[model samples]
Each structure stands twice: as structure tokens, then as C-alpha cells.
Target: MKSVTRSLRILEAVAQHQPVTVGELTKMFGLPKSTVQRTLVTLNEAGWLRANRKDTTRWEIGARVLAVRPAALQGSSLFAAAREPMIRLRDTLNETIHLSVPDALQSMVVVDRVDCTHAVRTFHAIGDTSPLHATATGRAILAHLPKADIDELVEHGLERFGDSTPTDDGQLRADLARVRADGYSVNRKQYRPDVCAVAAPILDEDGTPLATVAASMPESRYDEQRVPELGRLIADAAKEIAARRNGA
Candidate 1:
């Protein structure tokens, strides 16, 4: 109860002060800096708050927090619908499966996931964010969004995470073009050297992507020869999910 109370207070503080800093929170609450820091981290991880990219020390309400209204709940509802399918995919492939939605133009946040039981696997927590230009899951959705939106995201700058990550706008645009043509995106150690992933977008009735489903594994476990086949499996799964969702 005390922990919950403390977290609530932090949320209240953040709501009252937009783009506030840790020092400001600590001072205002008269709490230990470490306690405030931990609370802030927890809130940020839960998608209630986001630290500024330009100034990591400052924090503000996250997109998820800001999107608590009815319309945004569509994604939350999508998470519920995707649960069984994600689990089935994990069971079938014996690999970590992630369901993510666009959190911002430049990132996708994991809403749910099924972790692989393998001794070596790519691990990510729910609510974790991945860069659009460097992740299969992010690109899967990005490829389906408006070109103007994609251009704006690129204009913001692509932060490279790995040697294979695309940093140039032209190169990233070309990559997105391929994703659209192929109906799936593949990340070859672009986000993490040890992890590779394949992903497909779950489209709405209007053909706009609402979310993505991804399968990730250690590079060692990834069979290069099976990449196309695996991509096809995920793409088919995504389409089936979209069909079911539309029917519902």
C-alpha cells in the first residue's frame, strides 16, 4: 500500500508539472532521491511516463498515459484479442513472440509478449520501447503508415543501435519500401547484435496497421535458410488475426 501510495503521488506530481525533472520531484516530495528515481523508473517502464530523449533527466506523461480515452483503448482491446494468437505462435515456433503498438512516430512499445523457454532467447518486458528504424516490429508497422508520417519520423533523426541499423534517410526509406513489398520486416542484428527478429503488421479493416506481431530469437538460433519461410508464416498469422478482428 505504501509503495502504491508513493507511486500515485509521483504520478500526481508529474501531472501537475509537465516536463519536470527528478531533482524537482525529489525536492517537492521531500523524498530520498533514490526512492524518487526508482518510482520514476517504474512509472516510465509501465508506460505512464516518458523521459525526454533530448534531456533524459526530465520526464513527462507518456503517450499511453495521455491516451487513456476511448479511442486509444482500441489498442488495449487489440492486446486482449492478440493474446491467444501470440501464445500459439510462441508455442509453435518455440521463440519469444511480441505484440507491439506504435507508441510514437519513432518507436513501438510492447503491449504483451510470450517469452521462449529456450536457454538463449531475446528477452523484452511488456511496455518496453524499440526504435522504429532498428527493429523488425517497429518497421512492420512503420511500413504501413502514411509516407508523410514516415518522413517526419526520419527527419527527427534515426538513432543507430547496431552496426546494421539504417541511419541514412534514403536507406531507411528504401528499407521501408521493401517491407511494404515483402509484407514483413526482418531485423538482422539491427536492434541487438545477439537478437534477430521477423515481424508482420496486423492491419485494420481499412488496411491501416493497428499493431504488429514479432518473433525474436538469438542470432545463433535463427536459420538464415528459413528466413523467407518463417516470414511467410508470420505474415499469414497476422492476416488471419486481422481477419478475425474484423469479423469480431
Candidate 2:
């Protein structure tokens, strides 16, 4: 009973401070490092937590954790606010539209999506996760985060998903600057070889990104000449979702 209680507490702590190291959890719980490590390993085996890909010493919430709470997300304020906007965006662009929220600073989790009619459109499951530096929805959220947080994420080392992923620190920073200035982000075969997306952050009243709204399609259908138009449309959709979220 005591071990179960300790494991639950450790899981809660990891959820709150994900991509956290076992040493950090040990210090937080005032438990021996070995005890914390064992609990973490147990949780990892059970699919409640997963080690960060870049730094195996750190742990983050896993797919199973997300899978169990999907109903909660479906009933949440963000989902309610984003649903209409996502559908409208998909209809307008004839491309799959996704609503994603940041999973700590590690990745973006797709919470909902509206599919386009095209047979070859891009697709993402509700619990699908994407690297923050390699996807339009992820970069849109990152661009609105505090500088310190961005610096920490960069220091953690950006994993390369493909040739177009922004792994260079300086280059990523520059790209984020453009995202901020333009109020949107773009991805062209960055995270997925055949996916292209344009997205914008949905900011809360405090101007922090609560989620991102993206229009995604197959790379074969991506039109570079339409980037500015797509950026504007997606940015407007994000603003509408934000407004709806705030009860405006």
C-alpha cells in the first residue's frame, strides 16, 4: 500500500514537472535515488511515463497517460473553443486541421482534428505527439513561450527528425523570431517527410500560448506561393479560437 501511494505521488510529480530527472524527483520526494529510480522504471514499464528521447535520464508523460484522459480533453474548454474553428479552417482550406497543445516544453500533442475531403490529406491521431522544433503547431507554441523556457529547450538539444528540421540553435531562434513577427509558423517536410503545415498560436488573456491551430496537407499539394495567404488565414482562425475561449 505504501509503495503504491509513493508511486502515485511520483507520477503526479512527473506530470507536473515532466522531462524531469530521477535525481530531481528524488530531491522533491526526499526519497533515496534508488527508490525513485525503481518507481520511475516501474512506471516506464507500465507505460505511464517515458524517458526523454534526447536525455534518457529525464522522464515525461507517456502515450498511455494521454490515452486515458482523452474524454476529459474532449470536454475541456480548449477543445470546445477549438472545435468550430478547426472545422471551419479545414473547410476553408480543404486540408486537415489540427488543434494541439504543448506537452510541457517537450512536444505538442494533438487534441483534436478535422479532416479534409482529399484522399491523400495529412492525418494525426488525437494523441499523436510531435517535436516542438519540427512542426508548425509546435513552433507556433514555442514562439510565444518565455525566452528562458526557449533557451532551456534548446539547451536540451533539438532532435533532428529530417533534413528540414531546425536543429541549429541560431537558425531555430531566427525561425521563431519570424514566427513571432508574422504571428504564425510554417513547416515543410520537417517532422514528417510528406507533411506540410501552417499554424498559429491561440493565446490566452495573459498572451501565453494555450494551444495551436494548424492546416496540414500532403507535401505534394503544398504551394509555396500560397504561404502568406495560408499564414494569414490560420492566424485569423487562431485569433477566433482564442476569442471564443475567452468568452468573447
Candidate 3:
């Protein structure tokens, strides 16, 4: 019972100050480093807290926590919560807008979308699955996933979908790190030869990603100079969906 209580306390601390280091957690709990490390290892294995991919020294709440909690926007209501924002974004950018959630299989699945009317545009069905390391929408959610989950994907190896896909483990890791820092991800004809995209995570109150929002366009219409702007717009739209969920 004492061990269980200590584990909960450590989890609480991680939830309060996520991406925290062992030294910080030890200091916060006034416990020995060994004790904290042992508890952290247990929690991490159980999917309670995950190490940060960028800096393994730090830890954050894991994907398991998100799995136990219902998605911020889920079921039929998810479309209701996301439709307006998706349409608004598509209108603003004239690009295909996507709303997707990471599924039990650790793959991202599109739930809703607003298609661009352009002669040359990207499109996907409502239930299409995307590769975690190849698609912007997938990476956006993956960037916020627990390190243990990320490691599982890495161990499985990133498969190549197109010429631009990052097949190298180190390269993909670096890309995920960049996504974490930028709060978004971009794909340059990675998932499909003609498609370019930018995506952002929709996070819950605990900072766990519940889903992702993405804007995809034809390579001919995508401009490298506009990536940052496009990414920001997508991120803002995703946040609107998350805010609606939180308010409800």
C-alpha cells in the first residue's frame, strides 16, 4: 500500500510538472534517486509516464493515460466539434483538412475531413490509416505520444511510403524532436508522391494528444515558404476543437 501510494504521488508530480528529470522528481519528493528511478521505470513500463524522446532524462504523461481517459472529442460528437473548424480552415487555405485520432493499433485514423475544391488536391476516406513516421498528421500525434509508444514504433521500423519518407531511424527521431519543439509537423510528399501536408496535435487538459488536425495540398500548390504559416493555422484550428471539448 505504501508503494502504491508513493507511485501515485510520483505520477501526480509528473502530471503537474511534466518532462521533468529524475533529479527534479527526486528533489520534489525528497526521495533517494534510486527509489524514484525504480518507481519511474515501473510507471513508464505500465504506460503511466513516458520519457521525452528529445531528452530521455525528462518524463511526461504517457499514451496509456490517454487511452484510459476518453478522447477529448470522440464519437459522433467529434465530428460535430471539429466540422466547423475544419470547414473554416479549408475555406481559409483552400486545402484538404483532416481530423484524425490515434487508434488502439497505434496508428492514426481519419474520422472527418473537408476536401479542397482545387483541380489538384489530396483526399482520403473517413477511415484511412496513416503511417506514424510518414504522414504529417500521424507525426503530429506521434510527437506528443509517450516515449515508450514511440520506442515501440521505432522498433517496428519506419516503412517507406514514398521517395521522401524518412526511412532512417535517426532521421525520423530528429524529425519527431523538431515536431515537439515546433508544435507541428510537415510532410513533403512523404506519404504520397504528390501530397504535401502540415499537422498539429489536439491535446487534452493533461497535455496528452487526443487527435490531430492536418492540411494537405498538392505539391504543385505547396510552398516551402508558407509551411510555418500553414502549420500555425492548422494548430489554431485544432486548439479550437480542443477548447470546445474542454468547455463541454
TM-scores, all models, native as reference:
0.74, 0.80, 0.68
Off by over 4 Å in 2: 1-3, 9-62
Scanning candidate 3 in windows of ten residues, the lowest lDDT window is 67-76
**Clash pairs, model 1 backbone:** none
lDDT of 1 by residue, 147-196 (tens): 89888988888988888899998988898999999899999999887899
Instruction: Evaluate all candidate structures by whole-model CA lDDT and list the values in order.
Output: 0.84, 0.90, 0.85
The collision pairs in model 3 are none
Model 1 misplacement above 4 A = 1-76
The C-alpha RMSD of each candidate to the native structure, in angstroms, is 6.8, 4.7, 12.4
Candidate 3's TM-score: 0.68
Per-residue lDDT over 56-170 for candidate 3, one digit per residue giving the tens place of the 0 to 100 score:
9999988666544334344655557788999999999998898888774356877777898888788886667778789998888878878888888888888988877988878
TM-score leader: 2
Q: Give the per-residue Cα lDDT of candidate 2 at 113.
A: 84
RMSD (CA, angstroms), candidate 2:
4.7
How far does residue 52 in candidate 2 sit from its true spot (Å)? Answer: 14
> What lDDT does candidate 3 reach at residue 198?
93
Error of 2 at 196 (Å): 0.6
